[model samples]
Target: MTDPSQTPSLDLPDGVAVTGALKPGYEQILSRQALELIATLHRELEPRRQERLAARQEVVRAIADGEDLDFLPETASIREDDSWRVAEHAPGLVDRRVEMTGPTDRKMTINAMNSGARVWLADQEDANTPLWENVVEGPMNLRDAIAGTISFTSPEGKEYALKTTDQAQLPTIVMRPRGWHLDEKHITVDGERTSGGLVDFALSMCASATLQLEAGKGPYFYLPKMEHYLEARLWNDAFTIAQDALGIPRGTIRATCLIETYPAAFQMEEILYELREHSAGLNAGRWDYLFSIIKTYRTRGRDFVLPDRNAVTMTAPMMRAYTNLLVRTCHKRGAHAIGGMAAFIPSKDEEVNKAAFEKVTADKQREAEDGFDGSWVAHPGMVQTCLDVFDRVLGDRPNQVDNTREDVQVTAADLLDVKATPGEVTEQGLRANIDVGLQYLATWLTGRGAVGIHNLMEDAATAEISRSQVWQWINNDITLTDTGEVVTQELVERLVDEVVTTLPGDASNYEEAKRLFLAVAVADEYADFLTVPAYEEMP
Candidate 1:
């Protein structure tokens, strides 16, 4: 086959090498044409991605140096302009009241679609581990799913497939690629690695966009961890280029930016403005959002330090402000404002499941009442509860976009109101944090990105927040309210030892998990994202 990178239209980067021979199923998804599309995109977008990453550090430095984090003064005009509206949601995305998110492994791909949710987020990012098989097979699974032919049979003899319902009845597929900070080292161009986000988007779009369109959906995406509006702009331009190259109409590629970063929370309006033409909406995300805050403010002051991962609920002052601003900005721009994740995985224990269901019900009700057009669910079992909540509020309506929260007036102070959260640091919270982080990292290193922990679907963001809380507690010399114990390196090390001994998993993987965890949590400087260094050490 001819080299896709050699396509005359693409100016391939010199010396760029495509290492790691294609895996078993890679050819179907990573075809010559698909590779050329990825190469072309890397040539077009990676430079801007680098710049945006650097821009992120500038904001972080400013926050760390005691400079206030808030909406950009220069972009005030964009925020003030209220006339702009995003493109209409494509047909399949109009009623995303209950969306399920999971990695695109064969079993998950089939189950998520068959689950009664309205949409399935085929995640190649947080919900996915970037192993070689996962990177290549994920798109293959999606391509088949889009074509309505995906099925999987487990070794235990259970089989999963798309339901016999009409194509219109299946959950719409929205692909989520990796964030800017990650690299697809397995594939290289001009002897250097390309952005993982570009690789995931290009391969999936090239392989499945046409199939999705033929089935009434277009190439939709859930962009994660974008720190600036310009990053959204970069994505918008890439969408334009890819659509043009594929001969699809402009705006065919719709995106919902996950407002999961500290910087992004302050620029929701501006983010919509940048992606207006291609924007389907903005999503409120909590894990990575909390991680960003604790990661950035680990050293600033006690006020900036967060108490505990589990204790910091959406009712927290900063979280409330962020969600309110997200819904308002999205509606004002004529986009669907998706709510945060319902990570509860139903359990066999009746009491545990009952309590979880109650918590999810209240959470979904709060979001629906707050004007969220839709929300995300992690497992199939929780879908109906979410759907029911939205159904009660949105009777005979596709969305509550009309119910814009005009009363919301989130200011810089509101966005940074970390001190208002009513929670006290405690010994139990510290031990829980340490145990969760260690457990998550161990599973992550063993090739699982999303894990069920304490009946919740935890991901990279959970581990991030977990270890970050420990680091902040240790660095700030925080005292536990219940035990009166001051968090110190000695105490953390002792806790880590105890947790590692009790952690369930392969013992060797646990050791590696602990080493990586300490590198980020106990180091002199904070790791921007835990997965950055962990990705390198991914054996």
Candidate 2:
């Protein structure tokens, strides 16, 4: 933990304090204007943010007490009305055939800009570890990125910088802020911590909204982990206030909400309706969606239990329903329905790269055939693979939003058909979960949010899926299909111990990672999100 007395304090706005150390250039990112924007939003909407969070817990409690999750009756009219549509796509967002996502470190900022994707999801949420330095440098790097002066030089004397010669070829920038459940403890507003989402949004807006507008783009975002339409309303409220404060146009900011939560899957239309004026579309955040399924239904019987994370692919019946509904909902409302992430990172082994590319190609092809506008890729090498798939389907066209998918019909039961998913739990699967959970936590504790584990780019969402599956399996008394061994606390702990020995010796935070993983994986009451408790342990 950082001591307030040791950090450099800034001349911040009234009722705002900088508890984190401010490096020399950080003052420009957290300027008085930015602090004021965050402070104002925090004061006005923090209560409502708290209320929405409380509402989430209430829904969880209701579910535990035997209430079924379904579409909102109060917002049925919004879904029924066919006259409303989201605002038109801003410049550079119309043809988002491929998007690359990564944290805003200087090297990644430069690389993603040059990755040839149509948009770069400059992610500060799942792809970022919110160290005080990252909190400050994220906006700083983005500011430089917009200014077209971002560069990086590795310790080995290699050079990297943005492609300034052809400015038109650069990808549009879309930022993803932290979720509502998180607070920026490094900064305080009115004697309380401010929402990390608000902080990231404010600083990004203050630092680059006008610059991006001049560059033919506006303040664009990808919103994460919202459970209710009311949460979407709250985000729309934040976008309104931030844009007005920054003097941008009323709907200048466009947000693509990740329909990752189970309850959120049911409220897709309502969420779009709430943010229709400032909506970009919905994304199939598949990993987090899986994690949400396990978390939301963990307390239920074996009917809701999920098998290994890897076993539940996009082809699963429930997942197929989720994505099909997303594409239909977005097209019905004139929004662009984006696809899920392809996390395969190309490697040195030719056979490995061959198999991974084949899988990625098939995945993107399925999404395109389902009428998706675009999709996400984690590495630069796989950008062309996604581009080729979407290009084949969307040749000479920007997006396929005209196809409303009217023939597709999804019921609530279809979205909840976890029993139809094919796959069996094996001892190997459980060991993989334990290994991945501990490895991801260790790297995260060391300030890396995106790590390559077993050739796949693992993020916080993947880790959540890993740990949550362990908890759900243990709680539901799932037996391993291969070994006939029941999943128990003892089994998981033993696997954790065995996996720790095989972990990389250079993983500096190994022991804490082990402890943190077990804490969330075996606790009597499951942790809401692993990052909430893990944030307290961050340096």
Candidate 3:
């Protein structure tokens, strides 16, 4: 075990401190040079990050005060002209058929690399709870993996090590940092907290950019939770500075932005324009997209209030509009349009696995048919099914970028037609939402960010959709068609208590989960993101 006392005191910059424990060998990843570069980025980019976050709050306030969400009339010409295109794909990122996403712990790193997927998103964001040990240890594992020396053996004696043969078939490593809205309280610049997104990005980029290039893969990223083109502009600027400082070529780093925010959904063209020199593609951040819509319009009437989380399929009128717009916008601008997550995980029971595969196949089939370049799954078991569907469409070809989806034309009304999604608010949906929220939260409290729930992989975003939907349903007094139960704070508490009986775990953990769950689920103001509060409870 690494001793905290033996490590030399880091010559941290003014206003910064080692808020988290400096584990053994933390110095290797947090070298003096890397710290200085991160400080430079924090000093340079954090203020802009604060401004962008304020801009997001302003939008939320407008929607809260009866203003309708719509496209920016000012940037319509960028959307109309349609002549510009983002930079071509980075060399290693050309054929992304099945990208798997997970927290960047040691075991997940080895398995994800060997998952037979085209890309592995080393997530430091939604899928990961920012426990300090995890925050520091995650990159250590990645650094080793990049150097072909990563291995881990469990206490149970199950051993894992990187294989040379697997290296050739391993997924391209694309790191995803935290979003702009979060602050890295552990590190500060001039007594102010730095943006968590910049901290994760800077540390990883400063450490790995040149080395990745040497390995024939430029530093690639998946930008998450951006609410505007201005945020993308900020990242592009940061990329230039980092590259120049590191002596890497300009435009060598590529990023794929997740258009998860409702406001950003309207500015796809402008977002790509801002990152034109370094664009990879955009993602249909489907789960978070639902959470975003609710966060924006929770106070609006029933029209904007969604039915149930399960009922909002990709084919729902508004969802179809969003996905269709993504493929069209990305293909037209010469960027990849990656699809959403297939959260299905297999099981021991043949019948159970069969059902999961059937659901996942139909989902992947639709995405493949709709012109998505690639999609994601939660487990390795779902990879071949996604590959087969996309393979039938993209036989002998790495990608289908040449298939520009010209038949798609989406208007702003189509995007804002939230009430058009058909489904019933019901007793079953309410119980499921509450149950999923609590179950996932319990596991997260134990320092596990991703858990299998109902045979599907559930991440922080899954719980976000759950908790937010619960709050939305309660605030709206949504009526359940099946049981005629009106969702209320009192009723929700009762249901949570009932769910406690069903969840299999220590009573203490479930007790903690219940208390935290209700605080977010029953609060008058929507909690921005569950991970923010959950991180406070971590060791």
RMSD of each: 3.5, 2.1, 1.6
In candidate 1, which residue pairs get closer than 3 Å at backbone N, Cα or C atoms, i.e. clash? 15-190, 15-191, 16-189, 16-190, 16-191, 17-190, 17-191
Q: What is the lDDT of residue 501 in candidate 3?
A: 85
lDDT of each: 0.85, 0.91, 0.85
Candidate 1, 30: how far from true, in Å? 1.5
Runs in model 3 deviating more than 4 A are: 1-8, 165-168
- lDDT order, best first, reads 2, 1, 3
Q: List clashing residue pairs in candidate 3.
A: none
* Candidate 1 local lDDT, 1-539, one digit each (tens): 75765433322335455554554456666666667777778888878888888988887788768898878899998878777788887879999899999988999998888898998999999989887778878889988887778888999999888885366888998999999899999778666688898889988888889888888778899999998889989988888888888899998899999999888888888888888888899999898998888866666888887876778899988889899989888888889999999999999999999988999999999999999988999999999999999999998899988877899998999988898888888888888888888888888887788899888899889888888888888888899999899988788888888877776755566788888888888888778888888888775
Give a tens-digit lDDT track for model 2, residues 242-316: 888877779889999999999999999999988988999999999999899887877778888887778889999
lDDT of 2 at 261: 94
Residue 273 alpha-carbon offset, candidate 1, angstroms = 1.0
Task: Tell me the tens digit of each residue's lDDT in model 3 across 338-457.
Answer: 999998888999998888788888998899889999999888788899999999988888888888889998888898899899998887888898888888888888777888888888
In angstroms, the error of model 2 at 125 is 0.4
Which candidate leads the pack in lDDT? Answer: 2
In terms of lDDT, the poorest run of 10 residues in model 2 is: 2-11
Q: Model 1, stretches more than 4 Å misplaced?
A: 1-16, 505-509
lDDT of 1 at 303: 87
Which runs of model 2 end up more than 4 angstroms from their true locations? 1-9, 165-167, 506-509
